[model samples]
Target: MFLRAKVRKKDGKEHRYFSVVENRRIGPKQQKRMAQRTVLYLGEINDGQEAAWRKSLEVFDESCQRYSTLSLFPEDREIPAEASSSIQVKLSEMELRRPRMFGNCWLGCELWRQLGLQAFWEEKLSSQVQRETVPWEKVLRLLVVNRLIEPGSEFRLHRQWFDPTAMAELLETDFAVAEKDRLYRCLDRILEHKQALFVHLRQRWQDLFAAPFDVLLYDLTSTYIEGEGEQIPQARYGYSRDQRFDCKQVVIALVITPEGFPLAYEVMDGNTSDKTT
Candidate 1:
């Protein structure tokens, strides 16, 4: 069994929830074990109940309060320190209380806001053509860059940012829940525009490192998705890199220079041999 809890607080209210799910174990002992996850909804509680949950959560709250969250906030250009301190502290407290050490959407939004995305967002909104603004792109780019910097399951990506209302508010957008299909679509778009994406990345790299890319390295990866579709030029069955040949997958080549600058990428049928090039 697994337990899950959600806590929410809003309009001076608190709500608490607890749930459990069961799973089978296949380890050396091969026995069943209980898995528990909990979410607390502190937002629905009245003042009195809120106080009680706060009191009940005193240990965690204190851990948050005692943390020096000021250092975590980004330094904005020419902004008065006092002006941004409160927001920074609140964001820090939220981060400190998190159960894991992955990308925190609230923190990411706070940092992006401090980096002047808000002004860019407003500017783009006012444009006649409404061209894509640098800030919006930066935010998305940062999110993707973080993924490449530290790859993790899409579930983790969803869990870390998909449902955080405050984070959406900070980003001046809605928290459109990042479903797997949506994520795949976004990634596919990126792949379609891979050349332009690499050009932008290369420019940023040159500016940051004052160098150019050399000695491109290449490798391929495969992942089998659910369901069977007609094999395309880039889809086939082969040595399942994931050790599951029952399904067909596409092999995607990821190329990077010796200096770690990405050069190019391509996709082919899973049966396509990495040994080919």
Candidate 2:
């Protein structure tokens, strides 16, 4: 890969933007053509930053059959580097900043997109006003991704996980998406779409993996909640799987394919019998 510069004129001034790019051949063998694909965007580097980047950048010397440090700028430019393309760095002075977890977060987002959930949620959770600061779709995506990667409470995600993961970069969103209030509010809004979401997921699973629907496994489980659960009518003293008979609990019924793909789930009153539900 190499650094490529793109020049744009705004207000009669020429501005340059830089990106790391690589060339690839595409199309069938007979109709193959070379194309440049951008790997990363480095917006508007000044002379000093350019010099620093050049000092650390490395390139492969095809003729010499070895890797060598080279300046990104042209030879005529006033940049600091050895004339022969060799440079030295004081490693001790360098410091890593804002290092965030990326791979799992990226995978989660990619899987979300692959399942067509991005468009699905965008349509279902669209903002009513033009100036809506909250990107509901992205907020929901963040919650789903967080749950998939490291299941945690919205509070933990807001206070800890969001900042440590690369969700912001992946979603093109900021910390606002992880705001505890917004996360909770988003949950309140999605219940209406539960059935639709299940339908969409089922269709996607079938389309992508050809998941079978002929045979389904159904099961029931109970989880107890602490406190009085005053606002939750479904929370009641019942058969607790955890043996927390003192605390209120709710029953969850799930139907899944033999291959372990969830088809549907329902949360019922703790006292609801599995036979009745």
Candidate 3:
């Protein structure tokens, strides 16, 4: 049992009220409190009047739960008409895919063939010896055919072979860690055949651009080489085109048509003067 009492002054008079709470549960079933409040004001406060006011309040609460249109409404309302959307959002179904390289399928194939890709691989590249070799096809496709891509990007595209499923799907080959070392060795073979490699590439460029060539523009530029230095004569330091004067540079001479179709290219000593040629 519990008791609560309150004293309040109205207009200049004081009045007192009391309430009691009785615990109704006797066993482990459950327990709850029943409460009733009494007051001394006979003029306004009575049991019947308070019961009527409470019933009205209860009806207002039910109406707000049932028929209220606007979210904020008067005290008499019951229900709210507005409800939020309960639709579940769907995820995108797109699969992981490679980027598109060329649009016209036949034209792309013709252009690749005109680049002497097949002959360069089977004839010239096959004729050379490698200290350790991987699929020569893979290396040639990367360095020779896809030479348009930067060297840093080559490793990214090449690493697709590191996944067994991706390797089987793309190349129809089961790749392993052992194959990666062989791939590196085959790429090294490209340096040994650089002269012939560039010569063949220059020939292909000439054939592709010969019909369209009129005015040719030539410029000399240099790129900084990374890692251990090679004994190549052309890899030296002078005026660094890439602004890497602190490091030895690889000088390249690029020849292009007025329209910007590349025709020929040559590498020479970085210290060589462009004005002399």
Candidate 4:
């Protein structure tokens, strides 16, 4: 049994009451939590024992835990000039799971925040009624970050990559329930803002790096797709960077600063000549 105090201020005066509590389990059978079970309610303290009781109870409550943390200093050990002064260590009994690259997501999210991409999307993609738990902007950001870091398909992200990622928590949504079609729709929706995005990114790039645009380093590349799909209008027989000239491909034109920060890009038909694009 230990003392538990409750203090309330009423009309510029403090009223204090104490309780004798016992430890008990509260939550569900599978997820139990420690709670104080009140054994007796003691009236407001009018004596000196109140402070003493409070201090003792505080120590008792703190020590009633499952884990033990210890710090040790050896009396015979001498402090070496090159060695560290103190060594702090931690130990955990719980099994660690769901490991993901937190730093990668953090960097991606920070970049997005600095560029004001989230706010810009929210403003542009505003709707009359948003019933879904996750917003379109958030979904887009998740896909963008995933592409930048992991580089995978929507199916791969939804089925495999997303659950282990910090993206769900960072995007403020349940990613497991996020359908792949919604991601595709997000891609379609954001295409309308392509020009706007380029303009926004250009301003942010200049502001951040103060990079001069007097001269730009332009480049061209082509990615080959193995499947010959009837629906893909851009896919045609072209010179493939992957040495798969037999497969259909699409061409990409990129403009970057001397520092290699991309300022603009263009997607051309696979048959489009390098000089023509």
Best by TM-score: 2
Candidate lDDT values, in order: 0.52, 0.83, 0.52, 0.75
Clashing pairs in 4: none
Ranking by TM-score: 2, 4, 3, 1
Regions of candidate 1 where Cα sits further than 4 Å from its true position:
1-161, 164-166, 177-192, 231-233
Model with the higher TM-score, candidate 3 or 4: 4
Q: Of 1 and 2, which scores higher on TM-score?
A: 2
TM-score of each: 0.45, 0.69, 0.46, 0.64
Ten contiguous residues with the weakest lDDT in model 1:
67-76
- lDDT by residue for model 3 over 188-240, one digit each (tens)? 65666656755676677677665454577999888876654676667787888
Evaluate candidate 1 by giving its C-alpha RMSD to the native, one decimal.
Answer: 17.5
Task: List, residue by residue over 134-182, the lDDT tens digit for candidate 1.
Answer: 2334345345534644566666665664453243444454444244444
Those runs of model 4 whose alpha carbons end farther than 4 Å from true positions after fitting are 1-93, 128-132
Which model scores highest in lDDT?
2
